[model samples]
Target: MQTTKKSSGWHLRDVIMLTLIAIFFGFIFWIWAFAYDAVAATPLKPFANDITLGAWIMAGPLAGYLLRKAGASFLGEFLAAFAEMIIGSQWGVSTLLSGLIQGIGGELGFALTGYKKWNSFSLVLSTLTSTIVTFGYDLYASGYTSYSLGMLITLFIIRFLSIGFFGGVLVAAITKLIDKSGILNR
Candidate 1:
């Protein structure tokens, strides 16, 4: 008799869970827009977006950590962007492109782990990749290329810190809470 390993494909439950995550984060992203605008109006306008970017991309890493599956991060981030768009985000359709880029960045961390480790290291890596990927995107898309090298460095540092805090620290906390609540076992 031949023995075969069980496939780890996504089920309906996973879909529902991912959807809920996307919706929740989508709403959060929508509200975050106002906060972004407020920050932009300050003297720190140039770095405001970088400082607040981590919160915007949290859904991807959060979903990847929770789901522990390939493509979860991408789907989570993309769907959240979709939901944010549906909620009438100020960025309009451009949000979708951001989501796609962010999702790929978020997914790269787990991909580096071969979809095996979903711990602090992976989360940190996610933050790093997200910062790099998003910053790269902004170089042309958001006109970061026009900035001085010093300003670029400053933006990168701020972006990494922001992503590290929200996508790494906060995500670990949320996952820990979920684990403690025994929700996944149900």
Candidate 2:
């Protein structure tokens, strides 16, 4: 008799879960655009993107932790962005590019760990990498390079905080809840 190991590829249930997560977060991202605009209109406009970025980053880490697959984080973030575009996001097609960038950013941390650790430390690393990746993109795409060095430093700090809170802490909490619910065991 020959013995065979199970394939580690994505299954139907994983696809369904990923799609559901994308749709939900896509709508949330669309709604967040309005909030971003509102904040941009304020005196704190300079820091608005940093303030609201964490929410936009949630889906990647959330899906990564939940699915524990190699490309889950990237697909989660990208599909969510695609969904936001479909839902008439103010940013239109640019949202897709952002999603791609964000997805790669979110995936790097897990990749670094060989996709082994899904704990708080991994989450923190995810946030840090996401912040750095997104910030680098913003420097060129969003004209952040025009800002003064001090302002740039301030923006980096704010971005890290935002990503940490939403993508790291919040994701950790939500995953804990899901773990407690035992749905993944099914």
Model 2 per-residue lDDT tens digits across residues 110-167: 8889999988988899999999999999999999999999999999999999999999
* Steric collisions counted per model: 0, 0
- Indicate the worst ten consecutive residues by lDDT in candidate 1: 1-10
User: Which regions of candidate 2 deviate over 4 angstroms?
Assistant: 1-8
Q: What would the per-residue lDDT of candidate 1 be over residues 14-90, giving only the tens digit for each residue?
A: 88989898999999999999999999999989988899999988999999988888888988999999999999999
**TM-scores for the candidates:** 0.94, 0.94
Model 2, residue 55: what's the lDDT? Answer: 95
Deviation from truth (RMSD, Å), model 2: 4.7
After superposing candidate 1 on the true structure, give the runs of residues whose Cα lies further than 4 Å from its correct spot.
1-8
Pairs that collide, model 2: none
